[model samples]
Target: MNKRKIIDRTLLTDLAKDVGLNASHLEALGESCQWEIGVDGDMLERLVEIQHQFERLAVMGDDEYRGFYIEVPRPAPEEWGDAEELIASGEYDSREAFLADWLAFNPMETRWFHVASNRYGDSRSIRVTDRKHTHFIITNHSKCTDAEPDDTWCRENLTRLFDYLQRMIDVIVANPDGFNDYVAHNLPYQQRTGRIAQKEFNRIVPNCKIEVEDKETAIKALEDSVHGRSVPPLETMTIRQYCSYYRIANEAYEAYYRKRGASGRFYEDPQDVPEELRDVAYYKRIKFVDEEILYDIDSPEDFIRFATDHYGELGLSRLNIFASNKRQKGWMIIVSNSYSANVGLAIEVATALYKARAPLLIYDAEKLLRILLEEDYVRLVPDSYHNYMGYQEEGSVYELPWEYECSEDTDSVLNKEQYQAIISNAEWQPEEQAKPIA
Candidate 1:
């Protein structure tokens, strides 16, 4: 698969880069994004919604209309037939009819005969120019007519066109991370990150995994195995011969090694046995069971999707979700095949399942984002002054280990002016003047 490329852009930054147009036009031009999606398609889709605005500037309801610059080439003097003869001959009609005939009767001269529309005279043609200046208006109807250099053209018509362009730029650019974020929202409860150390076995499985976090646990586990701390050797085990040697009941065997087999869930209650002794065996293993593990997961998002899709029905219904950055590659390991029902799913998996059944309520998006992204500013005072020294002032300082332990209320972090500024900005966000995007 090809690596995903993330393209991030803001339209205002982009509008500045469109160097072809002058400041007059580009100054008011809004921004847009079209992340691999065609810009033309996006623009056209939005323009259809605001066609009603075009009528606001019309002199009369435009029927036969035009709105683009065209070369007004003078017809050759030779082709300019006698106006008197053409008029009296009953060939010429009104001013509009005469204008149409003038263009048709004239032969090609290759002057600045600009024609933006291929189907000009009688048909409808709409266009939106980029980086090039092309603005014209001609119409037989009164409602759609827009005469240049007039208030109607300035206020009603031009504003509407710029307004339409702004809407197209507001769409955010799509990226690969967006897909990951999307998957996170839709992820099923069963596919979150999990740990393998949380299982329980009810039977005597020959060999299984033992959980170890750091060097301390590993070292202790190692010491237990070498010193035979888990179980007494058969020779040292007095249970078998206890009936002969001690005159005690034969139940001595079961009593001495009570729950030693652990019914196989050794991790749950080793029954005072060392953790390294996950099973009756002396070997330290990292697996929960002896069977072959088959669930293969790649990315965190893929893990969620696959696990949720095949939860419980697969041989192994649980998965271990390891956190890794990009460059990792997908499989869902189910837990059913773990050979025992006592093996448990990781806490994250359980949390995910719980969330699936009862999702969290998001009352405020801004507050949630702030909480997620905010960093704590810890005030570590020097050891010399101690707790009570700096807190002489009313609300300037927060003493540690006492006020913190007591759960005392904190004073406002912002000063009066700072608070006022922040409050004003918050209140003004929606009221700020923005070029209309409709």
Candidate 2:
């Protein structure tokens, strides 16, 4: 057997530099020692030389590599005919028809053109007008065999060709403490890094309750529940199943509030509540109490008394306490000129009365004034104080007939003279004719 020539130390130093290794260490091992080293001892040295050869192949000129490689021949320039020529030759009827036929024959070549055009510059205007000719040009210029193509060779060798040099450099540069770990991880066929030991791997990737083969079925069931497509049976509960149940329950809570109007109060014990009625039941209980109190009041006096006792001072400003006679019904509300009416209180009281099965006929002070003026139910009294405060005196104020009453009583009646006098002198004008209410 012909013995392999011993690599000189100078050449070894240059190889070390090319592969990003410390050249000083190779240089320290002089020419005499390089020849003395045994075959087994010089295994790393031989690997460095192979790495250098691969690097040389990677950086070879494109034209030089293409000349050496056998490629598929290109079509003649005349083969790329325009739309008119294609139609005249009976190859295609229209530009679209020709393009479809060409694309079908050279799909890979069209893709390569897009990839190359995109990599080099703007490719928005570039299009496959002649796919057969384009395919031939791309294949003929490619520095790879007809079976492989340039992209295929680049994809295979781009990372792999540098892997040996990178691994060598990693070992040489690694800290002394982590040298063994570096070798086990960076060397061939050792891609997985974490939990190398079988025991550790088993601990991290625990077996599920369902078999591995049945995981897909279980996942689909869980997804169905999450998306509200279908609810899985409660008996077959898993982690994913429980998550779906929680989501469904939470959605039911939101829908309940949306349907019955938000009360701003969430259920106190969500865990104890049933999934279907978790949101509605809590609000229903609260509303039932409010309805019971409001329904028991048979007259406006009772309503005023209830508001006074339960809400005290804070409710007094909100309440426009009114009373209607037992017959010829007409409401007499006590209002203050100083206090501005609360719109929210009117809405809340109206909602409660509606829930108590009462007909809604309530109006604010401004609406009451408008109805009186429009209907001519009462005339203003010129002799009386035009801006009399409603809360100041019992009956020294504006007046209207039984039609203005929002209650069941019908015993009250106002004389025509009093009604006309009140309407004529009262300063409670329509908004367009009056200043802002004080």
Candidate 3:
């Protein structure tokens, strides 16, 4: 069997230097030097003694340790709490069960054998003995007093131990052969080339607002913006409400055209229309065709294609509403308090649409929903019947109602099989619900 070489003396020296005086003093203790070769039975026994001495010094103050060290009292194994008593008390079924529960409760307690030392000659040792493949704590010694153990002393010591172990692991994992090969092939130009490449890439692609090329990317950016509190509350209309406004504008424009007997020239530029009527005609021509597209979208794939094709228009319309001194008007507050309320739903719909178009992109509906809820764009709409259901607003509760409470007599009248059949045939219709008061 091949034993992996521990870190070389040079690496240990460098680590000791990095950790400063405390580690330097610990290194001079000679025990850590034995660890450099390999952890052996002699070293382990010596570590156990060192650990006991450290524990004795832990409770001693400067005054107590002025001339000679003072030994601290510790509970013996027989004095320790009994597992069999806990089992007999009915807290646990068996000794094994009691021990399992104890282990679970004290997850942070070290079960592995290890040694730790610091500048003050304070060291800790832990050794576990295996009997019939069942590991039992043989000697668990620490340099801390009972009071000190409850404080940050144990945690800080553990951190130091972890740091030392991590350094050893890092050196063990380092590939000298691989490094030599890389150096032989790449030479001095490799580092310079990498730096130059990265610099040029950054120069070419300077950071600005993320250009939302696809629905998923757009949703991600929006979610990030929301979490960062950078997404200002949308001040304008919901998409559905905006569509209605557009329809009204179109109707008014048509009325104005018909009154003027300009039916033949209706297709002409809105600019050619009377100056007073231009605003009406322009709005009438504004393509609010999203509803038509969304209405027929039966699958996620179809939605994606539609979103990709109309990405610019959808984005522009959203932005234009908030534009300063914009001519668009008559946008009623519908379905939500602000456009922000609809943003989550819009993202969901858009993402579905985009995923339909680009099936290759990884889409996580649950993750996106979570992000929406976190940002307050959407909320978890509670339902007694359904386990998972969400919506944009409490007002949208009209869309999802509680399951109708059936009388006991009704259930008796319809047998289990008959009721199942009726339920299977039942069609849920939102239109039947009473309209929510705005």
Candidate 4:
């Protein structure tokens, strides 16, 4: 309705066509005239084209321009003589400086359109996150700001946002014990694990009293009490192996302790630990494997196998390992002999495809490769990247192969290309998976 509202390219282009004016002409006119634009006579026709182009350009995706970008240079005074006189002039060398001053003086005209239109299209994206919680938050730089608001205003807003986030983080940190207690009470699985662990622990460490604040000390005491009594020394069990034994001990304790007075092969009357310990269950289930294992594992089957094998020696049935590190989306796994090198490569790849927001997928490739090269699982030594077994190629753009067999359906799996496409075009609505090729 208003000629002044025609800011983006789509509306402008359409208006241009309707009024026998081209996009180039309207843009030229906009650059040449500071007069308040109004819908009248021939100008109305140009107004329509301007509005059309504005709408079209507003929705264009980021990658639609690829390598092409427009660099608008300031026009000489003689070229836009009339328009230049209408607007204030200053001793500014750069057009950006002039624009800054121009915007300071005129708020309404300055914030007309945040995005620009070019041959390829507009450059803006809308991002939503459910899968990429920590991943997105961590990757986000303080630099990026919204288009509609100026950078200084956006910075002020972000400062307030960050202050709020900091307060939230502080709140979470200050109440870890309470949070753990809540989880134990509210979460069924956590309650089960806690009860079982406490029962089993009591058998090994008789009259054990667990204070929430002394979790680490309690764990150490349990290990010390169990070593040379029911199980091997603290040194004998790797962290992973200890986790396996602890969980089995818990379950076994639960089985034996609930029916108190019953004799058990592992320990007698398994209620040696206080029942209060069961109120904070999550801490009792200590995992030996580093959080990194989540990135290395492929199928749920692989996770299960890893869990079973680690605990099997301790006569444990199955261990539950939560993959806390590897989240569901915005990340993909890459196996490499050198974790450091691969991490660097991942970052490079991420930057090359920044629009995609691909997170570095870490695996136990470094450890495994060292083991493979050494021909001994127990003894490993750091070696050069090329010396590792996973190093198949030496090129800059080398395609790293998966060490383990991946699922056949690649469509569901997040890859570089797919990630790039998604980030490059936020408006893209991926088609539902057609039936996989026969």
The Cα local distance difference test for each model comes to 0.25, 0.28, 0.31, 0.27
Q: Provide the global lDDT of candidate 3 against the true structure.
A: 0.31
Q: Would you give me the overall lDDT of model 4?
A: 0.27
- Output the number of the lDDT-best candidate: 3
TM-scores vs. true structure, each candidate: 0.14, 0.15, 0.19, 0.15
Residue 149, model 3, lDDT: 26
- Best candidate, TM-score: 3
TM-score of 4: 0.15
Error of 2 at 329 (Å): 6.5
Q: Name the 10 consecutive residues with the lowest summed lDDT in model 3.
A: 66-75
Model 4, C-alpha of 348: deviation from truth (Å): 26
Q: What is the per-residue lDDT of model 2 for residues 1-438, given as tens digits with 9 covering 90 to 100?
A: 212232233432343334433311112221222212212123333423433332322222232220010011111123334767878898888877877665454332111110011011211110111111121111212232332212432322222323323433333232322333333322211111111222222232222011222333323322332343331112221222222222333333334344558666443534565674443333334323342334332343444444333221122233332222222233221221222223223333323322332212333334332222222122222122233324332212222332232233444344444334333343342211101112
Query: Model 4, 1-438: lDDT tens per residue?
Result: 211231233432333233332212223323321311212333333323333433422233344311111111122333333444444554665656556665443322111111122222322221211111110111111132322223343233223322322322232234434423433332211001111122232233232312222334323322322231121112221323323323433443344334446554432322544553321221233333442344222344444444443432222322122222233332132212233223222222222211222222323323322322222221011122333323322211111122122234553343444333322322222211111012
lDDT of 1 by residue, 1-438 (tens): 223333222232233223212222321221211101111233333333333323222221245222221112233332345655676787875545665676564433221111121123433233333212222322221233222224332333334444533332221122324423433343221112211111111011112222212324333323332342332222221111211111111122123234344232222223565443323211112222221132222233333333233222211222222211122121111111111111112212222322222111111212212212221111222121222212321111111121112222345333344333322222111111112122
* lDDT score, candidate 4, position 305: 49
Kindly report which residue stretches of model 1 are placed more than 4 angstroms away from their true locations once superposed: 1-274, 277-438
